[model samples]
Target: MSDLTFENVTVRYGTRRRGLTAVDGADLTVPAGTVVGLVGESGSGKSTLARAAVGLTPVTGGRILLGGDPVHRIGGGGNPRPLQMVFQDPYSSLDPRMTIGDSIAEAVPRRVVRGSVARRAEVTRLLELVHLPTDGADRYPAELSGGQRQRVALARALAGRPEVVIADEITSALDVSIQGTVLNLVQDLRRQIGLSMLFISHNLAVVRYVSDIIAVMYLGRIVEYGSVDEVLGDPQHPYTRELLAAAPRPGGALLAVPDDDPALLAVADTEPADPHHPPPGCRFHPRCPVGPLVHPDRQVCLTSEPSATPHRHRAACHFAATTDSATLP
Candidate 1:
């Protein structure tokens, strides 16, 4: 198992002088044999970081290291076996024209591709690993249910014999009844294969269920990162608190409001922060609950950006250290 580390990674688009920055110097890691859950609202750049890791997107700055070795582009002179991604929407990811066995065999490691028998055996093994029927491999993608297709996607990713897997909302497309099965299969793979993974999802409950550590992202930066318990039970950043309060509470209970109204969560009332015209200081300052909008004395948020480094809790708000999640509202 190798460590997947992002060293101050950044991704920008259009042009350097005036391009929009999608990921602003993200410092994160998926340790040797663990899952790191990346949770954030939409447009938070979570998928950008995942795409950059697998060479699907280019980075403007920083290095993506796999076990201390620099990662190269997947199709640009680099082997894709070591790092693989199971993208969202499994139906589109699979080839309708090819049989499932053929698709899975396509990703099997070169050493294991000696002959038809070997490839068929490997495909069957992966099919069983993902809790699918061995005979299903001979069928086409259109013949399978959404859940089964997703399982095939996972099997295809596993066919590569990857050291690290990037699960980009792998279960989001499945029915609620079937989400648990996929989530359980992922955990089982992690245990059975010791596969390190980066699990990205918008559902905090799902993140808490499958992650050892959780990283909360906002705008283009990581605002809070810590163990699942601390980050959820005792959140340190206002954005985290906002997300918790905004999430549906069990039994119709509501989380206590953070210092101000749900301005950030109230996406309709507030203008979405644009990556092209990022505000000075903190990119999320405009929607921050405890920013100058709530208290004029907190002008630092408008003039200075918070810094984040690896292996540290990155409560990227200026007032995070002094404030408590319960005391916010």
Candidate 2:
């Protein structure tokens, strides 16, 4: 087992000056045998960070280390791929024409197995690891249920015996009832294999369910990070607090529409910061409700970009120290 380490990693698209900075100096680590959840709103760059780890997306600056080796150098070619991705949409990830057995076998490194009998045996074992029936190997992805396809995808990712697994919203496309089944399967696989994982999603609740640590991203930067309880339960960043408040809970009354709530409207009216031309100072300050209402904090937020500092928890906010946990939703 190996840890996945990112040191001041930055990923951009096109030229540096004119391009979009999807991830900005992200420093993260997925320790061996543990899961790290990355939560953020749409276009927050959580997905980009995950892709950057596996070399799917290019890294514009800094580096990623897996087990003390440079990931970018080795990620492009390896017998057993160091990192494997389980994408959001299982249907799109798998080939409709290929049998599930073939798909899983295609990932099996030549070093791991040879001959038709060995390959077939390996496919059966992979399916069994994901809790899929042995017969499932004979069927195409289209014939399987959503949950089944996801499990097949997982089995395929594991076929290479990857050191790190990047699960990008793997459950978002499934039915509510089926999501639990897939999540449970992931949990089981994690314990059995002790594989380091990066679980990226916009659903805080889902992230909390699986992650040991959580990182909250806002406008391409990590705004808060800590243990799942510390970050999600007592969020320091205003954006994190807002996200938790917006999430609907069971039996809770419907939230007022954006038109009815000034705060919600403010959030809705403000467009996400452009990656190509990010807002000055705190990227979140323009839409932040606290910065405007608070006195001295407002000045700091408008003039300086707070560095992500660790003090029990890491938060990039000028007033994070003054934030009252009791007042947060």
For candidate 1, write residues 26-141 as lDDT tens digits.
98888889999999998899999999998899989999998888878332222346788998998899999999999999988666467888889999999999999998778999
lDDT of 2 by residue, 1-329 (tens): 88889888998888746678889888888889999999899898899998888878888888899888897566334378899999999889999999999999999888768788998999999889999899868899878899999999998999887898899999999999999998888789778888678999888778988889998888788899899989877888888887787887668833334456555656667766676788788988777756753344467777788988767589999878766557444
**Cα lDDT for residue 48, candidate 1:** 95
Number of clashing residue pairs, candidate 2: 0
Per-model lDDT: 0.84, 0.84
Q: State, as a TM-score between 0 and 1, how close model 2 is to the true structure.
A: 0.91
Q: State in Å the error of residue 198, model 2.
A: 0.3
Using all chains and alpha carbons, the TM-scores for the candidates as numbered come to: 0.92, 0.91
